[model samples]
Target chain A: AQTVTQSQPEMSVQEAETVTLSCTYDTSESNYYLFWYKQPPSRQMILVIRQEAYKQQNATENRFSVNFQKAAKSFSLKISDSQLGDTAMYFCALRTRRSGSARQLTFGSGTQLTVLP
Target chain B: SAVISQKPSRDICQRGTSLTIQCQVDSQVTMMFWYRQQPGQSLTLIATANQGSEATYESGFVIDKFPISRPNLTFSTLTVSNMSPEDSSIYLCSVALGGTSTDTQYFGPGTRLTVL
Candidate 1:
């Protein structure tokens, strides 16, 4: 079984500043995927960025980037030039590359992010 | 991405009653899943809704309490039987894009059930 953990329950950042939400997971499989999802007030789970374990490079989308340390079992999401709209509940999720029983991505408890403008 | 929709977006029910939440995907998906989100809690996988067969439930869950029916490829239903105050939560249905086997999954708006 895989377990994702988000240490920070809530975080605040000034507008246009950078904020990083930390996430860690416990998994035995080497071939897997990591994801950062943003859930705004509307409560829609929007995909922010994704990182493949095989690739050493981190994944980025617009201002959203991830510091993926596979060796440390850490995947943190960094939001640069943070805007008020960036405020939301951020969840870290994990999934195995193989299908069937391991297809699902176990999620973390989530961090409530508030971007102050 | 699949356009998934859950019927009865929000509903209020009395204790001991049951509510059936419906999940519909625009395109056929290889896998479908039902999840529950309690207040201030992370999402929990309720079961895997597989077409042409009975849904496979996870630990701490069973068919009698949360009966699932998947008659076709693009649709499924979850019934929360003998509802209680503790059963109130937001139920979501999710599916993968195409036959793509990634960790990424698209979710529906969700059904918010309030048990009184």
Candidate 2:
């Protein structure tokens, strides 16, 4: 079984500033994938970024980047130059690399990020 | 990336009523999944909708309560049976373009069901 934990239930950042949301997970599978999804007020789950465990280098997309500490089992997301549109519920999820019935994602509790103007 | 859409974006139902949520993907996908998100809660996997076979449900979920049907590669439906206030939630469907485990699953807009 895989469990994802997001310790911070809420966070706030100023406009044009940066913010980092923390996420930790525990899984037995050696090969796996991690992801950050943002659900805005529109109730749409949008993919923010993804990280592959096999890759030593961290993954970045535009202003979104992940600080993946494999040994610590930590995968945190950092949003630079935060905008009001960045306000949303952020969830961290983990998926095993194995096929069959275990392809579903195990999501964290989620953190509500608010970007203050 | 895949574009997924869900039908009946939001609906309200009385107890004991049943609601069937539809999920449609713009392109054919190998894997489709159903998930439920309670108020202020994270998403939980309900089942994996197989293209031709019966859906594979999670530990706490059963086929009887949440019957799923996947008639083809681009469409699927999930029915919530014997609904109660507890069953009221935001139901979403996700699709993975590739059948492989490494593929990223993209989600639908979701159906918000409010049971009265």
Candidate 3:
């Protein structure tokens, strides 16, 4: 079984500031993927960014980047120059391939991010 | 990326009734999934709907309680049977394009169900 953990229950950052949300997971599989999904008040779940365990190079998507530590089983999301729109519930998820098919994602509790202007 | 939409964005049903939520994808997808999100809680995958086969349910979930149907490559439905207050949660439908290990699952807007 794979379990994702988001230590922070809630986080806040001032506009134009930076904030990092921590995530850790336990997985025995060598080939897996990590992801961050954001859900706004509209109840829409949007993919934020993804990091492949085999890739040592961190994944960057504009202002959103992930610090993926495979050995440590830690994948964190960092938001730079945060804006008010960043306020949402962020969830960390893990996906591993098993029996020739990718399994469903196991998500953490989530961190509520509030960006203050 | 895939554009997925769920029908009956929201509905309030009686405890003994059942509600079937429809999911439609703009393009053909290899895999579809159903998830439940309780109030202020994380999303839990209810089952994996695969075309041409039966849906695979996760632990603590059964086919009778939450029956699923995958009629085609771009459509699926999830029914919450014998609804109760505990079943009052958001039901989300997601689709995976390419069906690869690295492919991301795109989510629909989600259907909010309130059972009384």
Which model scores highest in TM-score?
2
- The TM-score measured for candidate 1 stands at 0.96
How would you encode candidate 3's per-residue C-alpha lDDT over A1-117 as one tens digit per residue?
789999999999999999999999998899888899999999899999988888999999999999999889999999999999999999999988553344789999999999999
TM-score of chain A of each: 0.98, 0.99, 0.96
The ten-residue window of minimal lDDT in model 1 chain A covers: A38-47
Q: What DockQ results do all the predictions give, each relative to the true complex?
A: 0.66, 0.90, 0.75
Candidate 2 colliding pairs = none
Badly placed stretches (over 4 Å) of model 3 are: A99-102
Ranking by lDDT: 2, 3, 1
Tell me which of candidates 1 and 3 scores higher on TM-score: 3
Give the per-residue lDDT digits (tens) of candidate 2, residues A12-116.
999999999999999998899999999998899999999999998999999999999999999999999999999999999999999987677999999999999
- Candidate 1 stretches greater than 4 Å from native: B98-100
What are the per-residue Cα lDDT tens digits for candidate 1 across B33-106?
99999988889999998888778899999999999988888999999999999998999888877445654788
Candidate 2 versus the native: TM-score? 0.98
TM-scores, in order shown?
Answer: 0.96, 0.98, 0.97
For model 2, how does the per-residue alpha-carbon lDDT over B1-113 read when each residue is reduced to its tens digit?
A: 98899999999999999999999998988789999999999998999987988889988999899999999999999999999999989999999765486788899999999
